[model samples]
Target: MKKRLLSRLLLTSLSPFLFINTASAAEQAMIVFDASGSMWARVDGREKIVVAKDALKQVVRQWNPETQLGLMAYGHRR
Candidate 1:
């Protein structure tokens, strides 16, 4: 129940970015993801990395294919 609610809230907060004006020129988005050690910590008994991955999946599913998307991950390596 909590996970579903959190997912809905996350998607709602990002709705603006998901729906960009197609009338304008091509849009570009850069997603900066954190893969630090802290992300291994648990939230509500689930790992933060798991939560983040789920959210990213949701965002990508709704993303406009016409728009360019880039990903940059940090803190993955020592």
Candidate 2:
């Protein structure tokens, strides 16, 4: 039973990244993105931050403007 529980926990933990292609169906959904130094790195031809914000904005734009949306960024402090 313990082994099964452990496997389930691992599956749940990895499921988020594993199903990145699936869009959320919730009427309201909030996404938390880490905006630490790593996001400043290069991605494709632009910085990761630029890419992330653009991607987020693209998604947010697709949803209803009145739809509940929230964003929080964390950590770049000394």
Candidate 3:
């Protein structure tokens, strides 16, 4: 119940990142991830970090191969 909801919310929030104007000449995208300590907290019996990783994997699998992808993470260090 809660697990599904959490997953759905995460995916929904990230949907915008998946849908971009591919017609643009740049054809690039970047994912800004949260790696703060708070992400270690558990949500629906699973660590939030775990949930985020799973969600990112799904997103990457569906991502357009032609688009150049970049990732930038912050909040990992105290």
Candidate 4:
């Protein structure tokens, strides 16, 4: 039992180091927000466009330097 426990602890501790050398995070991210009037349209008693806009602003402000984003909207024309 002692030997098994030691081996289990050893493997558990070393597993993170093994991944430290082999694993890496991705390099890029992207975010987009729709600006259309329909995006602002209320659905299910909630305003989707308003919610989306606020969420998008928060996320974009917190984005990493390696990220890029594009925004587009439609249907507000006269």
lDDT of 3 at 8: 79
* Residue lDDT tens for model 3, 1-78: 887788778888876765566677878887877798999999868999888888888888988898888777889875
lDDT of each: 0.76, 0.56, 0.81, 0.47
- Superposed by TM-score, candidate 4 places the C-alpha of residue 33 at a distance from the truth, in angstroms, of 3.0
Highest-TM-score candidate: 3
Better of 2 and 3 by TM-score: 3
Deviation from native of the Cα of residue 16 in model 1, angstroms: 9.2
- What is the model-wide C-alpha lDDT for candidate 4? 0.47
Ranking by lDDT: 3, 1, 2, 4
Most lDDT-accurate candidate:
3
Candidate 1 structure quality by residue, lDDT tens digits, 1-78: 988776676567645554444455888776777699998998778887787789889889977897888777899984
Instruction: Give the RMSD in angstroms, all C-alphas superposed, for model 3.
Output: 2.4
Off by over 4 Å in 2: 1-26, 76-78
How does each model score on TM-score? 0.73, 0.55, 0.81, 0.41
Structure candidate 2, residue pairs in collision: none
Candidate 1 has an lDDT of 0.76
Which is the winner by TM-score between candidate 1 and candidate 3?
3
